[model samples]
Target: MRKINKYILILAAGVCFTGCTKFDDDINTNPNKPAKVSGTQLIANSEMYLPGIANNAYGSLYPQYLANTTYIDDARYTTVNFNFYSLYYGPLMNLESVINSKTLDGNEGPVENQVAVAKILKAYFFWHLTDRWGDLPYSQALKGSENLNPAYDKQEQIYDNLFLLLDEANATLTNSTGAIKNDIVYGGASLSWKKFANTIHMLMALRLSKVNENKAKTEFNKALNAGIIDNNAANFVYKHLAEETNENYWYTSYTRQGRNWYALSKPLVDLMQGTADPRLATYADKNAKGNYVGLAYGLSDAVKVEEYSLLGSNLRKQTSPVYLVTYAQALFAKAEAAKAGWIPGGDAAAETNYKQAIEASVRQWNNNDVTGLDNFLTQPEVAYTAAEGTRKIATQRWVHLFLNGYESWSEWRRTGFPVLAPAPNNNNKQIPRREGYPTQERLNNTNNYNQAVSSFPYGGSDNLDARVWWDNPNK
Candidate 1:
């Protein structure tokens, strides 16, 4: 009897020791971080990356709207670096949690409304990811530790899913009851969210204009009917706080860093100058000669930076708004759709949308200067030309999309308009179509990354020249 009791006590001691070492550790929470956060809080945090990871610098150089004086590599298409993990870990994860907690635990306010918002944001981030780098870890992504190595989903599938997400969001908003708080972008206005979701849907539909005409038209019609931002009053822009922590990244990069690294490109300056575009004065500052002078794109560092104009002070303002998408951009897309026969009413409709786009863009930058807007649009070169309508529309968009580089670059790729000349003295000999996948993916997620890149057009060496799936119009 004594021996048996002794054995049982020893077993109990072993069990307690195992619980302390393993079970307790697993169950412990880090009080510093959230075990669960409010849906609104998660949304506000996710909204921080709305302008995206890489901003105007990458976009401007690729589209030949801006040039780098010192670091000519980005301009020359030599050093193409972009990372996707930030999106995966940051906004995507937070959004996924919002949806999951709302659906599962039922704690988030008005599950339908919060879930809808989460879906919309998820679609937006995924759209950027798949567009920037063809094929991404989509369906299985944001699974946390359950599935660390998510499979790379095809870009086509991703687009299809994105459309479905927007459709559900639009429908859900119709009957939504709750409000999303701390909405840094929309101030929790559901109507603005509708315009934003539909606008983004229109943009995504236009993205398919090159690859899948049928899908493009179908989605375009759906989004246009649902409505989009009609005026700058409805634009999707994030005005930065005056505080340091959340100040505009561009302001920090340009002013605080003390680098006049960027200047307007020759193409943009000349085009605006030729048309006497009103936005030019807002877009750039005059050089020492009191005239707009731009640095030639892809110039070597040997060129003296002081001779050329620095970007306008507006961009470096602490509270300058970051353009995510604008009413003007949506108008331009509508014009393109009408021109392409994706919508009804032909060239006349296209002309209307095209002109409205230019007018709206001018006013957005020029503080509602009606005379300047009217005069600028009335310029012969700026007027709607039916014969070269597509080029005209695309060119205006290239200018209108200033500072919002990624979209401008994507527009250039899709429309093949504004016919950008290849950067001179580029080592690659061809313009980069997609930013290269991060080196970390190659090292850690080796197998999946290899499998994903292998599916690219160039047999997956992760080259900068590899065109993203949508970049090929003929595909």
Candidate 2:
């Protein structure tokens, strides 16, 4: 009877242990898991993207119109410079790792906020890529560890995919369920991300209006209907801190001796001078003589010394914000679209919006002053004239995009605005439509690069004036 009791007791103990193990397993099976992040950290890791993108776009290329040292000085310059290539590949490559890994890992339950941000950033980067290069690797380009050599996709296809991604991002940004943590641009505000997504769509549509009018109009209407960014408050800018490590792109470039090479060009200075644009004072500092000084592009060594002008690295200041997109730019794009009849609006309304865009841009300069803005608005050149055609609209857009050289250059290529002069010694004598594949790409993906180049119109040479597919025609 005692032996029988001992066996029963042992069985009871085993049953209790099994029950405890099952309870612990049930507790551990949580549906909501913390997101795995590696690439999104790259954006917040340092002040890299903000300054890096700003420096290349505003600091180097757009000022090509002004002709300065830090960039190519030959009358006709071709070939991808280091700065240009770096901006093109650096951010994309980093973001790609995060995106490709997440998709391939296939561990989806609840959506990761960082993954959504990565998608949005990826879309933004691709927008730049398409605007610059026309056709490039899109769907397969950023496969992380999977598929090392991704094939290139046409620009049209890329745009289609981009639109899809933006839609998904908009849907995924529902933060009511869970919040996005490290959003440096919008502070994890899902509403702001939605606005950013819509605004970017508008810009993208405007860019494609020349090539695909119907598609552009449709996208524009969608963005407008969805409600785009209304004012400067909604501008998508990455704020820079005064700290040396956190200094703006301009400050970093100008303060560093070897890197402190660029300056404002004569064309840019002349434009401000002619318009009496107040922002000039803030954009550039006066020399000892109180004159707005800048270097002329394509100048000889002796001329540069005599000029007493430096390249425009003023954008490198710690105060300078890295503007991913601006309310002013969006307004200007809308005005252009309206004038082009890409949307339902008249010239008067478009001109009003154009002037407003200019005002917004000037007001946004350094100080948010409305003083002198009215007088500046009334300038005969800026006022509405049907004969002005798209030139007027595009030129004003160019002015607003002044500090942002890459966008300015892209717009100029698209619309032939601001009537830039061809480089006197231009090898191809054409403005560069797109940067060539990076040296690494050439070395690593030689076959793919060669195949892509073969499809280019000018034998794949990085000619300054080679027009991309979207550029309407050579002026």
Candidate 3:
């Protein structure tokens, strides 16, 4: 029931600490950045970072949804060590501040509600970071003035703690107190927060199916039993505004800056166009020739941008919604879990959820219009078959997650469905399994960084090919 005040958000950004790896060791040394900020301000600042992460250029490129028209280095997988300091210092640190704050004024709802929201958000941010780069400084990293150089926690360990954090948040949630302010996502609605936390838990649990099936089953069912995003209205979406300060990322890039660096990747366009996918029109625009033509995925040579389709207006418009977690995601996760026997009813349940998942995805992407959905589902490749259920669910889920590159990339690594090939001229020769640790880690946290790289389960190498704990190719 509350709206974000841009001026307050601007003020929050100005006063908060800007850097962390060592939890911004400079904060204590500098007089300008505040040592402490309000719980409300901290949460607001953390929420502000979600849109940028959701529309991450690197994230989209990794899954081959978008292709580079000019700078092809990222498409070619040239960068090895992608830094995550922005995440840690930005949302992660801000959420941690809210979680640790002893003083709460109830401006953003009840004190307990604030802490619960903070805990869920903290878990979510860490989940995002660990998925990107395994073995992060979880338990030890947030202590300011106490531990400057914290050791990295293994990905498995981080996941375990993340599950617990979500559980704690879900347990503490109470009815919404209408006084909640500066809360952009759900207007501080406690039920919506509960569903979101549980939804996150369910998805994270499914991520472990390849590595630890028993734990995955237990956790997946636990979260499902608790609750999740059951309807489109309850989806975790970041609503972008028309204002320059808070406009959609694509709008800012294409409309304001007039930089059209990316086009729909050939693989994505071909698959969608071939399938008569209803969402394609909403996902991409017709090229100069007035047909939907995708650009080549990782071409080394310069190419004409006009030959390929650009991102759709629905996506690039200033007020376009950026979906983070959605009912479709929950349904697809359910479809996967049903096929895996994590939940009862087996193929029957899997088929039901799979059908609903596709419907939900079509509706969500096409602005709640299911005009051509029935015929689309009856297609041989799209239809749910028990023998081919996992592949079907995985592929559809990947499609549903368009523009959400990091999540899709993680799923592609785990499932190996709708098999994506290495970029033709990729520097690694294979698709990157994980991003290398930031180069700064080698200098600032030398010993710990070395320890993490050495203890890495898959090959013990700090290269892009090293798989994260849950991304077990053997499974």
Candidate 4:
């Protein structure tokens, strides 16, 4: 696809918009930046910002898969700014711009496909935002020349709209023709996009298992019938380039500093060792003694980091693929759904789906030892127990989503599986349920921000201790 820098494009929009005037005949004047761009260019630009949302440090730290060794602020929940607002000005705006441009002038490709993709992406970003901050400016967000302090929409409302957007994307994709230009995610293939939309809807449905069971079952059945990602080939993944500006975020962070700043966490290492998980080698490197050791998370002061295993080479490489949603996640979601009686299948189907999730995870990491995989599936503790089947799926999902912090932490909150311990040195005396809103929003949009914080069902404060709308704490 195209390689336009999203941030640069956003920053230089006014410069690009300046029309050619009296000096139109000058040859020395550069004409590289077009006065206006197509929906294709905007779609391509939006893909480049995925790393900002996916490869950041909060999700990994919250899930206890990776920890900051030198400075424990993030692990202990001291870091206030997770840069939540950058999402609205950056990727979200870019995507909405695509929708606006396409709608106004028609589309270079099929208008339906262009608008559908834009809507799907818009919903995707909104989902990411609302999950992090609870309620947000969803209904009125991305209005370029409209209201400044857009009112925040409730989390339930956002989810409803997201489901509708995904359904619309599915229909438009099936009915339209012409490849989506600059579509880096699925190479312009409409079928892949359709599967992605449906599977994403399936994932969101699973999130509602604790809060809204009836709605969850309804959406789950619809998404399942519509089809979802079922194999490695159809997984929603993206690989960063090897260039200086385009390298993977983890790779860039490590290369600029040292790799020892962050190390594998003790909880994750213990879990892997307890289960004899072969994926440990795939997640972390061996220490000086050639054994996989992990560092304790949330230490107050700087300490020796070389004593523990660093991140694995496969993940640290500039070319590593960042998995957003995967077949493994889909299987585990189904397993849990079946176990909860949301679907027609019973315990047997849950068992099958659970086993498939484990196998798919193993193979996804390139671990192809048949004997090891078979043993892993059949182990007494690893095997699916009738009473503990849901927990089994939840724990495996946490394992498979190793570096994906937000999703891993979300599942743990929803299912209460794996029983992750709270960080020892956290100032709050407990693990944080949701991050605080950005400081900028509090300053600039004080009234709106305060309104959202007050309307929060659990409490009217935007503290880390407050749970999001769907956070079924007792689960």
- Give the number of the best model, judged by TM-score: 3
Better of 1 and 3 by lDDT: 3
> Cα lDDT for residue 231, model 1?
87
Off by over 4 Å in 4: 1-37, 102-108, 367-371
Q: What TM-score would candidate 4 get against the native?
A: 0.91
Compose the digit string of candidate 3's lDDT tens values, residues 1-475.
Answer: 1244642463333433454456555455554444444576678778888887679898998889999988888788888888888888888888887888776766557888888898998988888899989899988997877887899999999999999999898888888565345677887788899999999999999999889999999999999999899999999999888788888899999999998999999989988887889999999999898999998888998679898899998899988888999999999999999888888889999999999999889888987899889888988888899999999999999899999889899999899988887788765468778999889999999999999988888775887888899998688
Worst 10 residues of 1 by lDDT: 5-14
Model 1: per-residue lDDT, tens digit, 90-131?
Answer: 989989987788232234345666777888999988888888
Candidate 2 TM-score versus the reference: 0.82
1-475 per-residue lDDT for model 4 (tens digits): 2244322233233333456565554454455544445676677677777766668788888888887878678788876545566778877887788667724324446766777787777777888887888888887888866878888888999999999988878888743566766677876678788888888899898889878889998998899899899898898887677667767888877875555678899988877877878788889998878988888888888767667888887887876888888899999988888888887678998999999988898888864554477767766768898888877788889999988888888878777877877787675556667878888788877899889988896773677778888996665
Model 3: residues >4 Å from true position, as ranges? 1-7, 10-37, 176-179
lDDT of 1: 0.79
lDDT of 4: 0.79
Root-mean-square deviation (CA) per prediction: 9.8, 10.8, 6.2, 4.0
Give stretches of model 1 more than 4 Å off: 1-36, 103-109, 174-178, 457-460, 473-475
State the weakest 10-residue window (summed lDDT) of model 3.
7-16
User: Which residue pairs in model 4 clash with each other?
Assistant: 59-405
